[model samples]
Target: MATNSIKQPLWAVVLLLPTLSSCGSMAAWWTDIGPSFVLQNASTGLLTHSLCHSNNTPLYPTDPPVAFKTKYAPKNGTSLTATGWYDTMTTWASLFYQNNNDDIVNAVYKCNFETGTYEEIESDVISDRSGTPPPNAQTGLSVALLGQQEGYRVFYHDRARALHTLKFTQVENWSYGNPISTSTNRSGLALGSMFSGVRNVTVVTPKDVANIETIRLNIDNAWHITTFPTPLRGSNVTNLSNLTSLPYDTSSPPPFSLQGWDGNPKAIGIAIDTVLTRHIFYIGTDKAVHSYAAFVTGLTESGFRAQPDQSNEYWPLADEPNSDFAIASHLGSSTIRLYYLSGGQLIEAKYKNGNWDPASRLVVANTTVFTNNTGPVEEDNGLSTGAKAGIGVGVTVGALLLITGGVAAWILRKKKSTTSDVEAHGDEGASTTAGGAMGATQPASTAQSPDVASQHAEIARTGSGLSTEKWDTDVKDMALTPPPRELESPNLASELPQGIDRNELPTKHHITELP
Candidate 1:
């Protein structure tokens, strides 16, 4: 038995050979997610992460979240939590965090898709806007990066509760922007974009008990503030701040205790489907993950899902969920991947093919760093979901076709993948977005991803716009290789670290700005 176990790991390396050789970087499933996620060890001040190695060795299967630590963590960094944005075009990852002095720090990691490695970590302390108290990031960190030439944006709050953005350009790293808006948004500061392209960097902030305000960035570089209506569930209007009980969902099993809406905004996670539907995920009082959608129509309740623990027991916000969550989707695909902390283990939940995945995959973590992806996972297609119809996932992986028969069971699992509320209390949203244009600019962003043609991706890797910074690495093409990863091992959670806390959380504050 021992000999066979040893042999199994060796065979995995053999399996990985084909996957690694043809091309690297399959957007989300491969490079997109590999850089977007950064796990941490709070006790050790170390960061654990993985490359785009989905076909990991059997000794640790489910493409185990590989353990690694970057050398750039600041000496006085407290909490050690981080958020990152992986610019697919540049293969650059800007990881942001709060240092001991409460100053914003960005540790940049340059990655190579062809080589399959995110080898080095370099960092810098972002400068303020001439005189803005150094823009201390007093709240959680969130980031959103534009593809190709547009640059990137990171959001946080200073001690004064004012929202600040740290943006990037080839001409500069992160130059602090003037304060855009201010409120009592102590937590739940998320930066995302509903459509594609370098249009609006949507900012979701808790203004107060009565409202949630969104400050958006336009192509012309001006900021626009919009107030969205409360979440609607089947004609009933209710804000997350007022709900104290679980909304009924036929998909959910009954809970243990019914009373638990502590009115706190623990965290907010957002995912976008290739179809252009956006789903926002958050934990409800009953421990179920609540989802709501945002479109031109307005905010609508999508559904809620309560995942099962190891014991198969269900509790109402009594255990598991620490409320810190991060979700991202691959461009051109419908796959939405979400990560959250449960009993110190990183719980990975996926929504794809119109259903929420029930797989109980857990990544052990002493701490975890979260990041943002522009869109969903690689879809069921040929090239990074960029190829529609018969195009192969690889711009052209003839070899991958040979292995399809070998991993048929995994593909079958993918085919079977498998939603909540209605309430209206105010204006749905902006109607000025005729075709989702970025404020009188181009039509709603045509979200860019890897398109295939003779082993090259349609999107360019190097940007002529960036002013040639020293941190920038030599340009390399991300071979539009289809991900040839294996099926997830069912026992991934068991093999990883495990534990759950029964602690109850006290509610925090929400935003309160109206149009």
Candidate 2:
């Protein structure tokens, strides 16, 4: 009897031990905390700086040093609006220079970020050949990027008034070389300002080639042979027309397309989040920001396929019209930020979980127009917003653990009398028969360990509360101001460009006429 009583309690303890240890396996909870801080110029206070790599190589001062300013001069009483940037992110940044002086012409220029200047890199100057008279030239540069593998990949708009893709490899610098001779007026198709996978998309136009029907560079042939129109025929690129914007498809469709997007013509190519699953970012078109998702595979000719099937839907962006938008991904968060020129000043908005939050103004320009105000800016820095948020959550979790421990102790003590007496009575008969065992197993020392039922309750309350509290804290902190950075400067510029001779610059929009 004595031995059985001892074994029973020991067995019970063993069984309860597993239940207690399992408490640590609770579900993990996370929430989007957004950017910890937004750094801007003290003068113009622009949040985004248009980013580009001069040679696909890392440079000094600007980290990899891939972006540049959109400075321009007026011609014949007309604003010669243009956009320029270093194209690739390698050791050499090919400059995508667009001289949108009403002709939709482009030239690849090589820029030296170390010296802070540029020179025309390409021998040929290419212009849009839509065969239709030019509607104002697309303000942004076109880029054809190489994916990670050796193959031909093209990103351009087709005649259906939609964006299209043709995957091939082995092409290099088709934009500068004038490789394809199609007479399509597919002007302003440069590599996207952003990256997808291993390379940027390549843009090209047919150079008066006959019988070719379709024009695409053969990437496997080193971009030298423009004969391989195989992918174009296989896909939808065979008969092209009405191509609008060129956005890299980063969706499950393995190169999802951004098609039929027309709103703000200036809203050309927007930046995308390379690290995000949804990959949300903004591009300016008709002065509005359009959102996109990358890496989705189910997209077909009919549009985004249904999920389970991963189907997609088209949402019209009517909010914040007439403002140019530049977006960057907030590191490690679902939040995508949009920096735009609005109300004559710089402003920002954050998109998360498919919703565009209200716009927050970042710069104030109540008066004079400034140079470098032609486009929005962006940057990718080494600072960490996710880490700061993690630290905050850790502190909260630690506090919760401490408090739960104290509460568990209080509960145990409150139930101690009944639990201890029951345990003592159970052992008394067997212990008294065993010589001197009663004193050895005194009631004080033999009190039952807290019940499993009580422990489960404690865990349920603590774990659930901790998750909820953490989420609430994250949402609240999204509205909190971000920290300051030493390297980042405000987008605001106090000085105008050197070429802006006071007499030459437009004065307060004195009703100008075209040439």
CA displacement after TM-score superposition, residue 280 of candidate 2 (Å): 7.5
What C-alpha lDDT values do all the predictions have? 0.34, 0.24
TM-score to true structure, per model: 0.52, 0.32
Instruction: Choose the strongest candidate by lDDT.
Output: 1
Please write out the lDDT profile of model 2 over residues 373-478, one tens digit for every residue. 2211112112133222221221211010111223333435543421111122123122222211101100011122345224212321100111111111111111
| Root-mean-square deviation (CA) per prediction | 18.4, 29.0
Tens-place lDDT digits, model 1, residues 137-173: 4354565654323355666666665666666665544
Q: Top TM-score: which candidate number?
A: 1
